[model samples]
Target: MSEPPVSYKRHRFPPQIIAHAVWLYFRFPLSLRLVEKLLLERGIVVSYETVRVWAHKFGPDYVRCLRRKKPSRQDIWHLDEVVVTINSEKRYLWRAVDQDGYVLDEIVQIRRDTRAAKRLLERLLCKQGCPPKRMITDKLGSYGAARRKIMPKVEHCQHKGLNNRAENSHVPIRKRERAMQGFRSWSGLQRFVETFPAVRNHVVPPHSHRSAFATHLHRLAAMAEWKSVTLTAA
Candidate 1:
């Protein structure tokens, strides 16, 4: 049986309006107020708070509906963790991405230890449904320890120079973090990271590009897919 379309029965605005609002908020580094301003420019009167509510309620639904790349045994996984300061407290955001620069998984935790590394590894294994050909990371002992316990057969390369791809993946999050003026709570940061990466992975051009025409086509397809997933097709 086919899955039912997304329900927007109680929303005051149309699905397209709400989905567009949500997309504007996530697809760019725009704040709620900025998104509201952009919508007002379109002659749509909506408050920033309304945009916030729409993004919170509908962002995950869009992520779930969006298509994801299938896991393959030949893939190379790059794993890394970065510290995020939330509400005067420190936390670690662990992320995994494939060789193609597609974000595979992310998790926020209180520690950056072996246990935390193991949890991230476990999540990736469950989500990807297969181990990659090789794992690369900075000289983080926790990752090495976790790899041995989780998948001893997987090739592990520990070198900062070779882990630039994983390290560079943190740049977008940093930009969003600065724009938001830092996150207020751990849960909120977790939720934002989850939704943000999915939208970015879908819309942005691939890490390695071929031509301007190809890039344009890539974005066009991304926008179409976004509309289809968000149930905002015209």
Candidate 2:
């Protein structure tokens, strides 16, 4: 007996619009309503609700695709935490980034204790699967404990002033938070942070390189190839 055929319904907006909407959502800290207004100004008539739906569906998918295409791995990793107030409660966002300032992973949790830190580290290790040769962090005791548990062989460097790379990397996210009025939920915060890093890595040129039109084109082309390979691999 033959199996029944499957049918897929096409979305109303073209792939371009869907891609554009997802980019806007992460590229800036704008809310869905603001994005819809901006699109209206650009002569694209789409509702804010539709924009929200598009972001929830396609934003992470795009980021995942980009990650798969880029095979470079971080050898040295930096870990840190930042405080974010959501709905009158203070929460901590645990973040890990490579030496080049590319975010590896992030998790927002209610507490910044050893348990939370350990969980975050485990998640990061599991996702990237490449243990850093050197881990840089501030004088946070939890980091010491977490490092010992997950990466016993890796050197853990803790000091007051040495982890500046990780500290400085939070500036972009801080700026983004100011524009969006803070994230409303833990899951939302995680999704946004995870997606933002890939977008930033794609658009921003290496610090040592000169920024020019040609450089911008090259970065974008590299990003396109990265995404293609990643999606195909997945």
Candidate 3:
């Protein structure tokens, strides 16, 4: 048989601690130093650099595993982009989400044009395995051009109000940018953005018309799912 997961092999810290550190860094809008200080209060003496290394090393794997555990997405998709300034350079962060506010995929680019929109659509198609019944976007001509070229049959609604779902999704990333004081490099930014939404999708449950007990049970299930996904390779 193949060896068991090496989540903690040769590491000074246990898998639980390392996983917790990675979780804290991505799950919340906390900086590496803050994560270190929080752990220090708990008697863990990990440095901020160690936490940074742990995030870059483990975050992508965790997100990939988490995505594998998600259910099939909706037929309606929302796409949008926001400007992220790093070291005085402006970049575009393209994001796509389903009708129920579940993040599907995101990417970073220096240009916001038909090409960028097509790139996002292609990534969505490859990952989602199908085009949506309809897609909503702001009054961006690039989205119109790209949608026509790629998924021409998928209804493209270009309305400001109609794309609020996608626009609203940027709020969290904007908050994160402030916490980290903006990303230093495009490659580094892309790496974290790609993984962050998957983790968010795993932890967040759809809002319910059901009772509080049902919500609590769902949260318990989400927590259990998180542990199982993280330990799959451990």
Which candidate leads the pack in lDDT? Answer: 1
lDDT of each: 0.90, 0.75, 0.83
Ranking of all candidate structures by their lDDT, best first: 1, 3, 2
Clashes of 2: 2
Cα lDDT of model 2 overall? 0.75
The residue-by-residue lDDT of candidate 1 on 1-234, one tens digit each, is 444567888888989899999998898888888899999999999999999889888998888888878899999999999999876788899999889899998999989899999999999999989999999999989999999999999999999999888989999898888877887788888888889999999988768856999999999999998899878888
* lDDT of candidate 2 over 74-129, digit per residue (tens): 47788999998888888888888787677777788888888998998789778876
TM-score of each: 0.96, 0.84, 0.92
Model 3 ranges with Cα > 4 A deviation: 1-6, 67-74, 207-210, 232-234
Give residue 128's lDDT in candidate 2 (0 to 100): 77
Question: What lDDT is obtained when candidate 1 is compared to the true structure?
Answer: 0.90
